[model samples]
Target: MLEKVAWMNMLFDFYGVLLTERQKDFMDLYYCQNLSLGEIAGEFNVTRQAVYDTLKRAEQVLSQYEEKLGLVTKSTAERNKLATAAAMLEEYETVKSDGRVQQARKIIEEVLEM
Candidate 1:
């Protein structure tokens, strides 16, 4: 579950970067396919330690880019806004009134714009 969360964050945070082919392949195998380091290494004909190091380096590069440009931070803030809007929608649903639902939908649209 933690790994899933990390991969989701990575996809959200670094999807715009121009990664090398090897880095893209490694990330896809590790995060999209949920492969273990050993499994990824075997697929690439590399040692497990090498695969681990590559992943670590890739993560560091992504982190550096995010820190410098704040893309990840903005994405996280947007995600939080959407989550809050969803909760508001749920609350409005329990009220069972068209006016309240419309107001909540408007709020959701504003949140989405953020």
Candidate 2:
């Protein structure tokens, strides 16, 4: 469940602008704010079923956007590559103490921060 929430958050971060304002609001409430369906429905003046359906639709839309664009996947892959490069640089630095390796590692860390 935690992983699914994290995945949804990642998808939302990548494709949330494509969603309607209501969709974004519900998503933020349910996922980021950790609100229950009943709670969200109460806040929105709607039924729990209505909130469920809207959330399901939003999830589907986000998943479809990811399927088409793969931005999240690409980003995860790039981060993984950067992490591997940083690790390799660290290992090399341990062996040689090269300032150039340290510089490259710092650059990779900056990119990962993005």
Candidate 3:
């Protein structure tokens, strides 16, 4: 459940501007504000079923955008690559009594700029 919420938050951050105002509002309330479906519906003066349906649709749309755009996928890949490259650089730095530190640093810089 926490993992789903975390992914939704990431997806929302990436593609939320593409969502409608009402969709964004409900998502923000549900995810960010930590509201229950009934609470959200009450706040909006709607039925619990209506809130559930709206949030369900919103999740569907967000997932579809992620599938087509893949911004989150690309971003995660790049971040993982960068982290691995950084770790390699750190390891090399500790063992570089042979003046290879500068070379390793340059390659790490290139990875970061990617």
TM-score of each: 0.68, 0.98, 0.82
Residue 114 in candidate 3 has what lDDT? Answer: 62
Cα error, residue 52 of model 1, in Å, equals 1.5
lDDT of 1 by residue, 11-95 (tens): 5346525666777778778777789999999988999998888877776676677678876668778888777877787777777
lDDT of each: 0.73, 0.96, 0.86
lDDT tens digits, residue span 13-77, model 3? 98888888888999999998899988989899999898888888889999999999899999889
Ranking by lDDT: 2, 3, 1
Worst 10 contiguous positions by lDDT, candidate 3: 96-105
Candidate 3 C-alpha error for residue 84, in Å: 0.5
Better candidate number, 1 or 3, judged by lDDT: 3
1-114, model 2: which lDDT tens digit per residue? 999999999999999999999999999999999999999999999999999999999999999999999999999999999999999999999999889999999999999998
The lDDT of model 2 is: 0.96
Candidates in descending TM-score order = 2, 3, 1
Q: Model 3 Cα RMSD, Å?
A: 3.6
How good is model 2 by TM-score? 0.98
